[model samples]
Target: MAEPLEIGSLQIRNVSKIFGTFKAVSDVSLNVQKGEFLTLLGPSGSGKTTLLMMLAGFLDVSEGDIALDGASIAGVPAEKRNFGMVFQGYALFPHMNVRDNIGYALSVRNRAVAEIEACVDEMLDLVQLQQFADRKPGQLSGGQQQRVALARALCFAPPVLLLDEPLGALDKKLRVEVQEQLKVIHRRIGTTFIYVTHDQEEALSMSDRIVIMRDGAIEQVGTPKELYERPKNKFTASFLGKSNFIHHNDKVYALRPEKIDLIVGVDHQDARMNGTVSSITYFGSMQRVIVDTKEGQKIEIDIDVWRNANEVKLGDAVDLLWADEAAVELQMG
Candidate 1:
């Protein structure tokens, strides 16, 4: 009859939401394990937000039910669910100082003053915002304010944390920095995190598992390596990571740029894919070579250009070689 510090099995079964004729989410189901970082990944308008809203109890499911730890929470209210949620914008209280902002949720429940102070202090330290505890949201940097917002969400010790593009507003460098901090915090707390993001790099970096969604349905779900190496289809291959899909009659192989290597005269050795180098772009760290193969095939290969890759040039002949096992043959219409 006691709740585990973190009870994180969320089973969303056959959930759907419709805005008249169009279905925002259609009969989607997912199982999130205890203390796991799961990302709901998709482009905009792909029903990820709708699904999250349903889980948060902000939006009702037009059908089906949601259960946490084996109990159905179909009609439960948001406040009762006690979920820690952060949106794209750092939704901090503009009027409150950082300390008060971090303590807001606990205050709403009228937790004891001393307990609130201790929890708030712990959260501020968790997010490294202890020095800025007295500053208002407007005075702190975007990253700092988001950190405070994250602290606030966790201050309540919610069972699960929901992040909807939580790092979307920060600049690139700050985003990367905060992502590191977030991973550390997640490890320290060991809570279930359901993060939603369209950033492929972010998803690949932060999540313990990724759920790729398309057209109100799940395209694929797996760890980063699994998704990248064994994408079920061309769409998932291209969506989760950089992939050059070799269109085949019965199957499709999603090959990554790094998997390609140049063999000056080995085309005939392995299937013989003859191609003319259409363009070569020298990226300081790598070179991207686009080859137009015989039979109108467009193949892209990324070669490390530190010094060796400078050897490649446009209009040059190249024989590409990859192990027969490297190619991920796929079938797509």
Candidate 2:
């Protein structure tokens, strides 16, 4: 069995990236724990990719420093950082077969030919691509090609692995399959993984901790459940998932769509509002109901399809009920 990596934590302190007049990343400080899967999540122009590039030693920092363990690696070259990078495009060499592609990194380091072959074989097995060892990139499917890329990146067992939207190119079903594979691989190798993506579900499902960024600055950082259930601000609440903002007692509060319950009869709870069923969208297993309240506020309720016993219809009057603790007060930004 291959030994798990002794990966050390990464410390990024007051890091910034500048492109002429544009500040792509600004004053970001974060700690990525050892052997943890940390994801940097944000929308376009949010500077997530730029930050990952700095971590990979591909981009020069405009200010501040990045250190692995206790040593500063701010001036280290990309090749000298000993980090593996997997890009969205899966940049595999078409001329090389799977075995050769996976073995390329070891060969470049001038390892013995037998050792390179053994490591390549181990990587192929790790990614479950052993059968396709002789197939070139042109002969493999997109997912298979990506596996080859991942295998190549891991053949030398780098301390850290960086992925920038590595599964973004695949279709939804294929993307999900690859995600499972990635999680499995991470567990087996126990290396530090810093992934970058804008997909909320992806970050929620895969990350040990997620760092949300906006406009080149850090917005919030927390575990997926914490970020989803107790977001720090309006931007995080709305961006991480669907949220309903309601004004009550002259204060704005955020509530999750799934937390609101809809009742067909008269309202009894103090936190109840009367609304018309404006729309209902049926997803498999669950459904979303949008209601236009009499107070001129729109509310959304998400419930299991089977639990929607009221069978509400469009134009029907309904009561939207939620507990007091379900509503999280938001700070105006």
Candidate 3:
């Protein structure tokens, strides 16, 4: 069996990347804890990928420094950094079988033949690809091929693993399956994983903490629950999940769809709004009801499908109620 890897932490300080005239990434500083699964999440051109490339040493930092375990690696080359990388494209050798591809890193380092074989076996087991060890990339499915790519990058026991949307090529169902597997592998290996993806669900479900970037700067960095429940700004609230912004009494507040209750009459003392049902959308597990308020505001509420299937419909009058604490105030941007 292979020994456990020594997990490492990262410190990104005032990092910026400029291309002649345009600044791709601006003054971003972050600290990643040891063994934490940190994900950089945002839409295209948000600079998430650009920041990852700098951390991997593939791109130079226009200004600022990056440190691993308290040591500066700003001058280190990509190969000498000893960080494993997995990209969207599998990039596996077409002619090489699973075992050879996984063992290639060790073989090139001139490790003992027996040592290489043992490490390869461990990697195959780590990714649950033991049965397909002899299959070539062309013979395996897309998901299996991606797993092989993961094994190859991890075989040498790099302290940190950098992934660049590794599941982007897989189908929805297959992508979810691989995500669960990746989390299991990370737990067992205890390696610090810095994953990059634009999928909000992916970041919310798998990451220990998420860094939401916009334009070229950091918008917010917090755990999934923290960011979802209490967002600091309009961008963070709307980007992380669906939010209904309420403009009342010269103040702005954000409320989640699920937090609002729909009732036939406005009898309670809590915050309430009266509106006519505008539309209803069926999503299998829950129903989304859009209400057009008398004040000319459209609010969305999510109700359980089984409980509220026939309780309300389009053109029906309803009251939306919620506790005062459920409405989170946001700083005006």
Candidate 4:
């Protein structure tokens, strides 16, 4: 068995990246704990990729500092950082088989032949690719190719792994399967993983903490549950999940679809609103009902299909009820 890596914590102190006059990343400060799965999540042009590249030493920081385990690595080159990297393209050698590709890093370092072989074998088992050791890149599926790429990056037991949308090329079902596998690999290796992606579901499902970026700055950084349940601003709330924005008495609040209950032909006094069902969308597991209120606001409620005892249709009058605590107030950002 391969020994556990001495996982290092990372600290980004007011980091910024600028291209001439354009600020790609601006004054972003974040602290990542040892062995934590931290994901940088945002849409395109949100500076997530730029920040990741800076962390990987591919881009120079225009301002601020980056440190590993309390030591400044701002001057370190990408090759000297000893951080593993996995990209979306799965940059595997087309001519080499899985074993050779995974063992390339060790071979280049002039390690012993037996040591390289053992490390490659261990990586193959880590990624569950032991049976396809001799398969070329062309012979493997996209998911398998990605696994090989992961194994290659991790074979040398780097203290940190930087992944830039590594599973973006796979199909939806395959992507989900790989996410679970990646989580398992992280747990077993106990190495710090810094991931970047624009997929909300991927960040919510896999990350120990998510850093939501917007317009080249940090919007919010918190655990998935904390960000989902109590967002600090409108951008964080709407970006992380589906939310119904409610304006009441000069205050703005966000309520999740699942938190609202839909009732027909009955009215209650506690945080209730009456509306007509505008549309009903059937997703396999749940039904999304959009209600247009008399106050000219559209609210959405999610009802589990299996637990829905009452059948709701479009144009039906419905009442929406939710607890006061379920409505999270938003601040202007």
lDDT tens readout by residue for model 2, 90-120:
9999999999999999899999999998898
Tens-digit per-residue lDDT, 9-33, candidate 4: 9999999999999999999999999
Name the candidate, 1 or 2, with the larger lDDT value.
2
> Which pairs of residues have clashing backbones in candidate 1?
251-330, 252-329, 252-330, 252-331, 253-328, 253-330
What lDDT score is found at residue 146 in candidate 1?
86
The weakest ten consecutive residues by lDDT in model 1 span 263-272
Clashes by residue pair, model 3: none
TM-score each candidate: 0.95, 0.97, 0.96, 0.97
Rank list by lDDT: 4, 3, 2, 1
Give the per-residue lDDT digits (tens) of candidate 1, residues 1-333: 013464878998999998899999998988999889999999998899889999999998899889998899889999899889987798898999999998999899999999999999988878888889999999988898889889988988887899989999999999999999999988888889999999999999998999999889998899988988888887788888788877666667888988888644334566447677888877778888898887788888888776463676677777877787788877564
Model 4 TM-score (2 dp): 0.97
Off by over 4 Å in 4: none
| Model 1 bad stretches (over 4 Å) | 1-4, 265-268, 307-309
Tell me how far candidate 4 lies from the true structure as C-alpha RMSD in angstroms.
1.2
Pick out the ten consecutive residues of candidate 4 with the lowest summed lDDT: 263-272
